[model samples]
Target: MLELRLAQGNLLKKVLEPIKDLVNDANFDCTPTCLSLQGHTPMAFVVLSLRAEGFEHYKCDRNISMGMNLTYMAKMLKCADNDDIITIKADDDESDKVHFVFENPNQSKISDLEMNLMDIDSERLGIPEGEHHATVRMPSAEFSRICKDLSSIGDTVEISVTEEGLKFSTTGEFASANIICKHNTKVEKAEEATIIEMNKAVSLPFALRYMNSFIKATPLSNTVTISLSSEFPLMVQYDIAEMGYIRFYLASKIEEAEYEQ
Candidate 1:
């Protein structure tokens, strides 16, 4: 048996919005201390971690993995109001369906939905720990806007980072553009500041489509952290207040000329 209650139901909604776009089905692995999901496509990989303490109520009889279609779950979540309290219940031993309950703050309204679970076979990928060449922390809204604007100009973006700052560059048939954000700690709010830590300079090209898809998580956090290294995939992370974080990883694109060599 397992159950979890979250006062801020919108967080789950926001988490699912981007995931459904990238992955169709996934397993939600729940343990006593945490609930995590990892899904990926050929172009991008995503990992979501939510700590059990973040929930108002959390219970688990044993570790279990519940497989379901993300799009279907997102649709059910859409019926809930932002202020609604959400409770999820599942039986590890007996049930093939997961139950979701939504209740208004006043307790004047309540709704329940159940969706069938699947037996999905998936293995969690182990992400190795390594230092990034450049780590940039900036406002989430700023990153979203940059991806959206760059997508309009080109399908790929060259991200370059130096001691000075971070730069996003793109080129189209008609024109090319570049946007640079400098490091600055002087801000009214820390979340609004652009901070960069660079161990070495690195420039890599990535698909803008995946970047835009990752931007759907902008609503979950005020600040976004981007880590880039020549040896690893680009990582964009959004930390959820005190709950946990969602991370998206995309591999850099190699030029045709480089491939020929």
Candidate 2:
């Protein structure tokens, strides 16, 4: 048996929205302490890793893998409210369906949902940490808005990070626009403060659509983290309060010609 309940259903909503688009089917690796998912998008350009700790309440017979139909799960989560407590349960050996219960304490309302699970066979990437040319942390809303504004002008957005700050820009056939956010040294909430660490300056270009897709996680966390290096995939991570994190790895579009000054 596997059972978990979250204080807020929206946390699960924000976490699954961006991932469901990447793949129709996936697996949720459930343990006594954590539930995690790892898979690539259909196109295979972007990879995702999602982990949510046992918040509120958790119970598991043992370690097990529960296959998920992400599309069905996404649609089911639409019924959830930010304040509603969400609970999930399933018998690891009995049913092919996972059950959900949503409770709104203030409204004295409750709803139940269920979706049939699938047996998904997929490749999971090994995420190895290494030194990055630049690592920056800032308010997630700022990052989401930057991507939104630039995406209106072009399909691709370039991110340049240095000791000074971070820059976001886009270029079209006749126009180019840029925006920069400098690091903030002081802030009351350590989680919301902007911070930067750089070993060397680094710049890379990525699809604006993908960046925008990642913004959906803004509802899940207050701060966003970005890591970039020439030799590795671009990493964008968001911490979901007590629920762990949602991480994305995207390949940068590289051209030696574009690097020429």
Candidate 3:
């Protein structure tokens, strides 16, 4: 048997939104203390992960890997009100269908649905969060605007991070643009401004599409951390209060010749 519960449906909706964009189906690796997911985008350029700990109202009855269709589940989840307590139930390890129940204590409202599951093969990647040469922790809302603004002019954005601060830039055939954010900006609260550390400066180009997609996670967190190094992939993480966190990793774009001589 497998069961999971959350205090509210909207919280569950927010928890799963970022993953639905990149993955249609996934296996929820459920344990007594946590429920986590690990998967890559269709092209494998970006790796997305979600980690939720079983604390407070969150609970896990028994360890089980529940294969689910996230898209259909998301659709069904919309029927739930923000204050509705959401409960997920599965009969056993071999259960093909899972049940979702939403109840509102104030209004005495109830909604329920059952969805069929699939046999999904899940692979967990060994992505280590090693010491980064350059790490930038900035307000997520600001980062989202920068990505959205630059994406209109170009498909790729260049990130340059140094001990001083961070720079976001992009260029097209006719124009070039750059936005510089210094480490000590008075416009931001001491805790909200850009914080950076580096041994050597690092600049790399990443697809704006992927970045814009990542920015969708802003609703889940107030701050986002960007860890960069020449030897490792770019990592962006958003911590969801006490629940856990969602992380997105995008490999730096490398241009190559069409034919080798």
Candidate 4:
């Protein structure tokens, strides 16, 4: 028997939207301290995983690998009776605890909460495991601005990094954008004493998707940190709230177009 209430329903709604693109009919791991799920986008080219843990008193470590279609769930919640507590129920012989809760003040449709337990042993999501070339901290606001500006120029963004500074630029289409942080920028907090170098760029589309997913969970901030390399995934971190943070790893989208001589 578990009962919990959240003040804001939009938070959960927003969290589920982007994830809905990646979460299919898959099993989710639910433990006493957390409820998490990680699934690959059908063919496993892209993966999405989420964990909501340590919010309240929790017990047990039961793995709830139940296949609940996220699209169905999202639609259900959209029209669910926003009553109050989103209750989750658990049955006997409880290998995993299942409970029910309410949305705002309405009741969620019974048909929308269906789930199935299947064999979910292997994990599909994996992070880059390699030595990074450069690591630096900046403001999330600034980073977000760069992404927005680069996106304005074209569908692709080129990130150039060097020991002196970091450059964000875009071209090739009917638009153009560029931003240079020469060792220090007032809009961002740079640690000049450290080894922060870059001379590379990745696609703005991929970066936008990955970065938006990471920073979407919390309030926008002025400070962010990043770790990057020419051949490794870029690591972006943002302080969402007082003590909460969201980190994202975006794979480098290397361009294959040859420049005309």
Candidate 5:
């Protein structure tokens, strides 16, 4: 048996909203220590890890993988109030359905939902731990705004990180725009500051549509971390307070010259 209770039920709702469009179904791997989901679309891959300690109550008799349709799960979660307490349960041996229970703070309302598990076959990708060429930490809202603004100018945004700062640029048929964020550790709040760590300068173009989708997780964290390397996929991560983190990995677009070669 596996059970987990979360006081802030809205966290699950916020987590699902960003990735439901990108992935149709996913496996939620439950263990004694954590509940994690890993899925990928053609353009992006995502991982959500929620630690057990963050939950109000967490119990696991055995490890289990519960496959679920994210769209349906999101809808069910929508039925819950933002302040409700959410309890999820599944029997490790005989359970074909995962159960969700929601209770309001005043105990005036309670709701329960049962969703059937799926037999989905997915291979988990092993994420390497190598250092990236550059890493930029900035406010989540700032990143979202940059992606939204750049999308209006072009289909793709070129991201460049240097000692000076981080740059987002795009060129449309009629106009071009550049937005640069200079490194600054001094701020009123640490989360509001933009910090950059660069071992080497890196620049690459990525699909703005996907980047915009990734930023849908902006509400989950006050700040977002972006790691970039010329040879690897760009990683955008949002830490969920004391719980865990949601990370989105997007491959850089190949330039016409590189594709031709």
Candidate 6:
């Protein structure tokens, strides 16, 4: 039996929050070193992949595949006791190694396990497969502010990018909002290109909802990455900690009469 006590609760929250929004019963195929979890939502599904070079006291390269129940993982992490020994059911087929047991109490921990994982559902995980016309990463806080600003004036937010800069605008039956990118607020980087290509504007409501979760993790960075295209999904990535990041993808929702007529 492998036994361990870890304290990195926030890390668990970061990993589960975005995934909960995508899948209901997530299967964590975990070994001692790597983890890969993926599920499908109606609109899109996200695959979380992670790796650790060395784990626990004894350094032994052991390959073990364990299918953990989400509900069990949820309850264990939700009301985690200080001495909770996370037990894993081993494969009867493989030989046991003394190094398979991981013991380290100095891990991480967090409060809201539910909040850590975003809205878990089937509908929100769908993503249309196609070649994206454009992609760019931006400051998540800046993008979140832009969404809130444009949302105050109207129900819809229109995002556009050009040679000049990126712009957020919204206009409905009566009100409207228009905001432009500034010199340092949002821009093109020397090492990386700024303002991902977009031939048209996407519906902002869903995009905002998706982004809200992206920045929920602690220790916010100075910037967030935003990638978009006319016919493909929009992707936002937040680098929260070392080797810990959250990537959110949202499909474009455009009314047929907007620009196709």
Q: CA lDDT of 24 in candidate 6?
A: 58
Under the 3 Å rule for N, CA and C atoms, how many clashes does model 5 have?
A: 0
lDDT of 4 by residue, 157-246 (tens): 556666547767767467576777665544332422223444443223243545444554334345666777755566666543332444
Off by over 4 Å in 3: 42-56, 185-191, 255-261
lDDT of each: 0.92, 0.79, 0.77, 0.51, 0.91, 0.49
C-alpha TM-score for every candidate: 0.96, 0.88, 0.89, 0.63, 0.96, 0.59
Q: Which ten residues in a row have the lowest lDDT in candidate 2?
A: 42-51
Cα RMSDs, all models: 2.0, 3.6, 2.9, 6.3, 1.9, 7.7
Alpha-carbon runs more than 4 Å astray in model 5: 255-261
Which candidate, 3 or 5, has the higher lDDT? 5
Better of 3 and 6 by TM-score: 3
In the range 1-261, model 5's lDDT, one tens digit per residue, is 888999999999989988896899999999899999999976589999999999999998778999999999998998998999999988766578999999999989889889999999998888756889999999999999999988988998999998768999999999999999999989999999999999999999998988988999999999999999987789999999899999999888873335446
Report clash pairs, candidate 3: none
Candidate 1: list runs displaced more than 4 Å. Answer: 255-261
Residues 34-82, candidate 2, lDDT per residue (tens digit)? 7878877522233433334537778877987778888888888888777
Candidate order by TM-score, decreasing, is: 1, 5, 3, 2, 4, 6
